[model samples]
Structures are given as C-alpha cells and as structure tokens.
Target: MPLKQPIGQKRLTNVAIVKYKKKGNWFETACYKNKVVDWRNGTETDLDEVLQTTAVFKNVSKGVLAKEKDLVDAFGTNDERAICTEILTRGDLQVSEKERKLEYENLFKGVATVLSEKCVDPNTNRPYTITMIERALKDVHFNVDPKKSAKVQAFGEALPLLQERFSIQRANMRLRLKLAAACKDEIQSRLAEHKVIVESKEADGATVAIVCQADPGLYQVLLALVRDLGKGHGHLEVVSLAVQREGMSGEGQASGDIQGILKEQQRASELSQVPYVTSQPASTTGRLRARSEEDSMAEVSYPRGPISGIPDDVTRKPMFLEIDGLQPGWEVELTKRGESGVVDAVFFSPSGEKVGAFVQARRAALSASKKAAAAQSTVE
Candidate 1:
C-alpha cells in the first residue's frame, strides 16, 4: 500500500470536502494546500479524481507554479505567491493596495520594516535585524485598510466606534453597581429604626409593609416654612406628633393658650420693628382670639400647677417640641435651669418624661453657643 499521508497533509488533500450532517453541521473529510475545499459534498469518485490531480502537482497547479517562478526571476522571492499569502495572514492584511502594486514592489514597501524588526522573512525564516527594520519603516506606508471605502460606509466606522461603544457600556455598568451598593448600605443602616408592620392583602399573599412613624410630608412642609422665615430662623424647627388618649382631654386649653402666645409674640415682634400687614391672617381662623382685643374682658383660665394651663391649640393638636438639628437620642430636662437658657432643643418621645438623648445634647450645645456669642458681642 502507498505511504499514508500525514494528518496535516490529509487535512489539505485535493479531495478535501465538507458534508453537512442531518442536523446541518459541517463535516470535514479531505483537503489540499492550493485547491479550495469542495463546499458541495463530493463523492468517493470525485475524491479519487482530486487525488490524481494532487499527484500531478505537489503544492499548487502547474500553471501557478510556473508563474511564481517567472515572477521570482525578475523581482526575486519577494513576489512569490506563497510569500503573498503569508503576508496576508500576518499584519500586512491591513495594508492599503491603492498606492502601490500587488507584487514584490508593493509587498516589500508595505511590510519590509515590520518584517525587518517585528517579523521574519518566510522564505529565509531569519529574524529581522534593527538596521534593516529602521530602513524599511522610513520608506514604507502604513498597511492599514481604511474603513470608509470609495464604495460604501455606515453610521459608525470601525475600531474607534467599537471602543466608544465598549466605554459607554462599561460606564453604565459601574453606575448601576454604585447605585446598588448605596441602596444596600441604606437598607442595612435604617433597618434598626422602629417601623409599624402593616399587612396588605394582595393577589398572591399578604404583603408586610414597613411604615415610618415620622411623616415625611409633614416634615417637608415644616422645612419649607422654616426656610421662608430666613437664615435667622435656621435654628427653628417643627415635628409631627399624634395625640394620646389622655392628651386629647386637654385639647381645648392647649389650643387656646399656644395660639394666643404665638400671635401676641408675632404681633409685638412685627410692630416693634417694621410692621407691614398683608391680607393673609397670621394664624388659622377660629383658633386664636377672634377679635385681637375682644378677649381683654375674658377671664384668665389659668391651671393651678401650670400643667393644666396648656394652650387650646396645643390640646387640639399633638404635642411636639421645636429644636435645632438633633441627631438621635437625647434627654429632656425640664427645670428652672432649662428655662433660663434658650429653649434651643426639643425632645421627642412616646412618653412625656423620657426624652431623646440626641435631641437634649444638641439643644444644650446650641443654646450654650448662642449665649456665648451674645455675651461676646455685647462685650465687644
């Protein structure tokens, strides 16, 4: 039997054919170095013919081989078809063909420097020397295929467009990651806050809803009111509260007194300085004295221990304290000493006695600072 061809040689045999499987997968059979693979499945008889063809010429057909030899005679081995194929596979595949010829002159001009320094000549298989490489680079044009042809072009061109697309994708991914991380951190930190667990009947199941006791809408409205009061009122604050069972009993007294005090103070402060009365009422209607001076004949309904002397407005609405920026946790010390100092802080609590430690500390600090500043300014 004839010597079996090597695996590589068999892969490129003249009869190299591909047959699609029933599932439509391509199957490789035989091949040759020069002849193209038969995309249409050639039979055993066709394979025999291909083998005969291969026997006549080892690599390429006789005509091609003769042409290669003739070109080499005039322009040297640089013009060899084998060399051209090698150049195509290598970096020279990017070379522009418009400025130069297709044979030795073009190939050498395109890749001589690169072959000298970065690559080796296929035929010689020798490494490129630095001096020869430098000489080639100086004379050679960059062998890059420009994306826009005298033929057709698209909205986005080649590599640069691809790079821009990749960059935008990367940025969006990073932004999403950052947002996710921030949300996770917030959920972990605020988890300790006491929330009312509300149950909702849904189509699938009962959903547990966590509700914050502090009303965000009320807080926002209060903040806006304070802002309108100017920078001098930056320390002013308000809190939302709900009345307890016992607290509702004193609503009438609290509402009357609180509204009265606020209106009197506001009127006095405005008149003593620069009073510009507008059509808008200072406080809600039917709350404060209907007629400002009409209440002069009214008897003072003062409570004995002063605790019963709560304002009517205070009684109607829930009791809330106004304080400076308090973080969390503070004590409420209601004493003669507290009265002497500016009531700069307000304490929040479910019970009357125990106050938030954070609010107390904050109020104490702010009051001390304001007093000290006033004292210093007086002395100066």
Candidate 2:
C-alpha cells in the first residue's frame, strides 16, 4: 500500500494576490505555485496550472471563497479594497520595482548624510566625506532593510561599526582660560580629574588666568562645566594647537618641533587678536562678574594695606579710605575728587557695584596749588 498523505495536508508556496473591482463587484486575482504573473502587462500565462495550484481556489471547495461583501467589510472602503486588490493582482510590476529601488537608494543616501553630520574625523575635527562613508559602509557589508528607513538602518547597524573602522584621533591643544573667581575651586577640582597639565596661573583680583594643556575633546567638557558653574561668565581661548601627529619618531626632535610650532601658532593668534592678561585677587566673594569691553583694557591694581606704626597722617591728609567686605581685584573707576585732589583708592564688588572711595590730604593740597597757579597765570 502507498504511504498516505495527512488529511487536510496542502502544499505550501508563496502566493501573490490582487484585489480588483469588476463593474461594481469586488474580485481577487491570484498567482500560485510561484507562477510569474506579468503584472505590468496585465497578463497571466499558464492559467490552468495557476488555478490548479492557487490556495484561494482550493479553499473555494470548502466554501471559503471571499466575496465583495467580505472585501468591503475587511477594508471598510470600496476604493481602498479595490486599489489593494489591483496592486496585488495586476498592478504595473515595473513601476512598483522602480519605486522600491528608489526607496532603497533614498535610504542609503539618508544614512550617509547622518553619518557625515553625526560622526567626525577625529584628526581634522571634520565630518567624513560621502565617498568615505560609502566606502566604510561597503567595508562593513551593511545590508539595507526594505521595511525600515535608511536613517534607522545606518544608525542601528552601520554607524557603530563604521566609527570603529574609521576612527579619529584626539589632538593636543593649549587653552587660555579665564575663570570667574567664584568658581575657581570647582573648576580646578574638575580639571584635576582630567589629564590636564597646568602651565601657569595668574590671580590679579577677581579674575584668574589659567594656561593649560589638554586634549581638544576635553575643551568641550570644560566649556559645559564653565557655563554651568560660572553661570555663563567664564571664558576660554585656544592659544595653540598640535594637530594630528605626523610619524616623526625621534623623541627629542619631535618635542623640539612641537614646541616651535606652538610658539608660531601662539604668535599668530596674538597678532590676530588682543591678548588676555589675567589678574586674580588673593580672595574672592564667589560671585561671577561680567567684563565690559572697556574693562578688558583697564589696568588692574591691588591696594597696599597701611604700614604698621606709620599711623595715617591725621594732620597732613586723610587720603583714600578702604571699604570692608569688598573682594580684592574688583575693578574701580574714579568718579569724584576732592576740590584740591584726585581720588586715591577706589573699590568695587564682584558684580561691578561700587563699594566706596577716598583721596589723600597731600594729593588734595597739591591739586589746590595747581589750580591756584593756573588762575594766577590766567590773571597775568
């Protein structure tokens, strides 16, 4: 006896079905057993063989044939159901293929654009070119997913691997930083966490000047830190750069060349812009102050406390008086002067608020004498 095939057993193959409208009634056209339906030409060859193998027709014997009502109920719209049926059954095959190809190409381009924008060449700090990105994609042999958008495919599958294969190198750079006195401690603490080398530090009054060497990537991190801690009052300038290294092996020669290049770059930068001269005070009030254009050019000075036992001249003159509670190094402008003299010591708060000022008695007297001489000369 021959082996029995299972009951209700059916051969399985991918089927293509098209729903279409005939007059006013909904109908479905199908290709079965891998039959090649010429969708573009609206032609079907081997109709007998296709009908014999079609799954839908096989189910017709079981009273499972779908009617126009079923199509309407499933799609909820005659137009939509008809269009779907037409696409499945007799839509232009060449046009559909072209659309699919266009979508795939568009996705590829989108992925390339994203990679270019998001990832940068580490050495140049610039984005990779489209060609370079394409080459990278090729190297990775990335597969494009028809169901997903190009950006999704690039980010999800290609970006990480491409970055790994075409990595960028970190550059060495020198930075001149002007930190607010209030945030000095915090900035210093954060800098200590990185491999930064402090070349010099100058504290005049409320402003501190810091010259340091670090990787270029760390500059962004420091900027964020400054903006947060200094409340937008901190400033930084790149003084020099040691771009992506060349293959020079001798330690001494490489060091000498690097130093020479840095000097040249620094000189060029200085010639292009005004140099920043920092003056930090001995103590700070922990408040950030804005620096005006005029203030940048102003000369910064500190007050000298009265010498011990050299009692202030009560009879000769009482010059400038010191204001308590004002942080040192605050910028001061002389606004008023005694009739005979010029103001001596002026003080300000970190936020540019004036504290107080005074003048010396001797200087007042000298100023009075000069006025007297000028008046006498005018009379003569």
Candidate 3:
C-alpha cells in the first residue's frame, strides 16, 4: 500500500450559482447559499463568508474558468474578485428546487402574518391569530405567490376570500367633515353609505359640522365629493382612528380646521368670502344661514348655500352624470331649468342601510313598472 494523496479542503460543498450576462457571454460565481441570501437581504456583510472562492467562471457547474481577455472585455476588469462582485450584484440568482419551495413557504407565512394583523372576524369582532389564519388558508386552499409582496397578496387576493369564508372586514375609521351648511344635501347619499353615528351637526356662521364613523374606503370618495360638490368649501379631518367597536364613542375628534382641495380657479371667488369652517371640541357647531331673502336664488327653492360670484349661465351645458360615476348609496339630485326647489328623489330606505338589498328592490320595481307600461299601451 502507498501513502494516500493529501485531502484538499472542500469549501464550496453547498454551492449556489449567481450569473451575469454581458456581451452575449455568461459570467458565473459560486457562493455559499445562506450567506449569499443573507447578504442580499442586508443581514450579512462579510464577503469571505458568502464566497467559497472569488473565481469567475464561464460555466460554474462545468468548472470551466473564464479567459482573462474575455473577462476584461465583458466586465472591464481582469480581477476575479471584482468580476465576481459584479456578477453577484447584477446577475440572476440560480436557486435549487429545494430553495424555491422554501421561498414559497416563507411567502405563505408572510401573507398569513399580514392578514392576521390587518383584519378582524366580523361575528366575534376580534382579530384572528396567525394560527387561525394559516388554518383557514389551508381549509380554503388559498394560493400565495412567491413573487408578490405579503401586503399586496393579503389585501388584493386573500381578504376577499376571507370575507366570503369568515365574514372578516377591515376596522372602521372615524371621520369628521365640514362644509357650507347648505351643501350637506349634495353628498347625503355618500354619507348614508356607512354606519354614520351623527356625532353632531352645528351651523357655524358659514359651515355645517358633521362627524361619523364609517368604512375606511369612504374617506377619499368623500374628499372628491367635497371637491366636486362642495367646490372647495368642505374638508374631512381624520388623522386618527382604529378598528370599529360599539360606534363613534371614542374620545378622538377632528383635529383642526383643514380646508378641502377647492378648485384652484375658484379659490379667490369661493373661499375668500366664506369663512373656513373649523371643528370645535366634539364638533359643536352653530352655522349661520348662508342665504338671504333678497337673493334671487333663494326664491327658487330647497336650501341653497351662498356661493356668490359664480356666474349663473344656463348657457352651461346640462350635466349628464355617467352611470359609472354614480355610487349606489348616494341620493341623486337633479334640477330642471325652471323648477322651484325640492323634494326627495328617494322615498324608501332613507337611512342608507342594506344598500345591496335596496339596489335589488329598486331594479325589481323598475322592471315591474316597465312591464305594466307595456301592458297598458292603449293605441286608441
């Protein structure tokens, strides 16, 4: 028997490949899997721990070394370490099948964690634990994508299914709004869309203060409503709120007198004359009547707010609201060229509750009326 050859130190036993392509050629590097991943995610910094050897290769799996001239041409350097760094930073990471499965499992956990934190069970009014969310996901067979973010997947995909399965919903946000007192009718439909506990309605000299708790999605819609309907004389202040409880009984109230995004062109004309409304402690309001008896507009009808200096041009085209732009719960108001003021458009479901039910009922009623009209066609 002869002496055995010396055993070389096998460092890169668990090798992972990272490859970069430049000038139609691939430059590859071998790195330790866990260390390279930790480095990529900013948790690891030691390059020595990440790299088995800083050797740049044409094909890492085949152990074919890259030529010095090609390396210089492709990466602008002949240094193996520099070329390796470039490859690792800018290249695609080649993970094994096992790593892909591991990453998908991680994504599942992340999405579950997010859903558990952001939503609540409607029946119990309590947050679902991570375990509960995970188990429910299994029962429903919810698929989590490894490529997407946890928050995105949780909200866009998981929440709707969770709602169907468990009736889970996001917690409500308490919001406060103030506009010209006469303008409240403009957005009454929108206000009725949620669980609005009338916190208070005061007529300040120029404004009416209204506070209520509602679904979180309504804030931006309400903002746009003020811009379009209130024309810049309204604002909603809701910097603080959490999940819904009994109602808007919390100590939180509107913080300040923030104004709405009034139209820039009308700012000088509309905002200056009207005193901006401010929320008092608990939204106690006392609005002065905005119209006077002698004003010609006051002669025609329902409550009208004083937005003076706006040109009264019936020459303006009659606005036809698009069906897509209408929200179901909002009360719609329309006026003719020569009509004196007002009566309610909606005679039923004034509280704005069960809007889906209200919609189905309204459709059925319309269908019946159409059929009766067809049946009663008297040719004479």
lDDT of candidate 1 over 84-174, digit per residue (tens): 2322222112122443244334333334332322222111112223343323233232233332221121112221232221110000000
User: Model 3, 1-380: lDDT tens per residue?
Assistant: 99999977544578888888999888888998866666666567777878888888888787788898889888788988777777777888898889988977887888887775556533222345466667667666789875467778898998777655444566556667888867876556567765354556677777877776666677787778777766876788883343422111101112211111112112312212443321111111211121121122323222222112113452211221111122222232222211222111211222333222222335544555566567779532
| Cα RMSD, each candidate | 35.9, 28.8, 23.8
The lDDT per prediction is: 0.27, 0.46, 0.55
Worst ten-residue run, lDDT, model 3? 256-265
- CA error at residue 354 for candidate 3, angstroms: 33
Best by TM-score: 3
Look at candidate 3 and give me any clashing residue pairs. Answer: 189-330, 189-331, 202-285, 203-286, 203-287, 204-286, 204-287, 232-262
Candidate 2 lDDT over residue span 1-380, tens digit each: 99998787454434444444444544444444233343232355435444433322213224345554555564565453344444355432222465567656766777876665444433223334455566557666776775465557766787666545444222347787887776777777788898676779888889887888777668898778777876778888887654321111111122233233234323322332433211111111111111122133444222433312123542112222222211223343432122212123443444555433221222333455577688889999
lDDT of 1: 0.27
TM-score order of candidates, top first:
3, 2, 1
TM-score quality measure for candidate 1: 0.13
Residue 234, model 2: lDDT of 80
